[model samples]
Target: MEFFYFLLIGAISGWLAGQLWKGSGFGLIGNIVAGIIGGIFGGWLASKLGIGGGGLLWQIVIAAGGAWILLFIISLFKK
Candidate 1:
């Protein structure tokens, strides 16, 4: 269903972000959480900035961007 698809996207997005940023992964579950949260942040950012992407692929792109930013912030704090 749509809900499940969103969760899948979140997991993938988080995993991708973690891979992109070395040593920022928090395992599978944590990644999922971060991605889901990041998705929201990304969507909001896109909306505020008047940017948009259509379809599922676009959603993943937006989420990945957000997840990466989130991980980057987390890494800064961890340091």
Candidate 2:
């Protein structure tokens, strides 16, 4: 189903973002949650930046970028 595919990509994006930004992952459920929310944030941000596209690869890139931004913000508040 489309929903399942979305979740799958979200999870992968989150995990990838975590690994790239922090050298670790937030576990399965955490990754899924972060990915989905990040995907939403990423899409909004991309639209604002005049970036638009389709396909699984683009989705992952956007989601991961969003997740990285989210993580960076969180780290800032943690300090």
Candidate 3:
């Protein structure tokens, strides 16, 4: 189903972002949430910028980028 795919993508993206960003990522649940939200943000941003997001790989890349951005913002607020 599409929902399952979304979740899968989100989980992978979140995990990857956490690893790349060198942050805790708020654990599995938080990572999932962040990734899902990141996916939406990335998709929207890409659309708004008139850029093609490509396929799954590109989706993951965008999602990870968005997730890292979210984490950075959160960290800034936490500090």
Best by TM-score: 3
Model 3 alpha-carbon drift over 4 Å, by segment? none
Which digits, one per residue and each the tens of the lDDT, describe model 3 over residues 1-79? 9999998998898888777766677787888788888878877887888986578999898888888888778779978
For candidate 3, the C-alpha RMSD (Å) to the true structure equals: 1.2
- Candidate 1, number of clashes: 0
- TM, every model: 0.88, 0.86, 0.89
Candidate order, TM-score descending: 3, 1, 2
**Model 1, residue 74: C-alpha shift (Å):** 0.9
Which 10-residue span in candidate 3 carries the lowest summed lDDT?
17-26
TM-score of 3: 0.89
Q: Per-residue alpha-carbon lDDT of model 1 for 22-77, expressed as tens digits?
A: 75577777778889989989999999998988888889989989998998888789
Better of 1 and 3 by TM-score: 3
Provide backbone clash counts, one per model: 0, 0, 0
TM-score comparison, 1 vs 2, better candidate: 1
Model 2 root-mean-square deviation: 1.5
What C-alpha lDDT values do all the predictions have? 0.86, 0.82, 0.83
Clashing pairs in 2: none
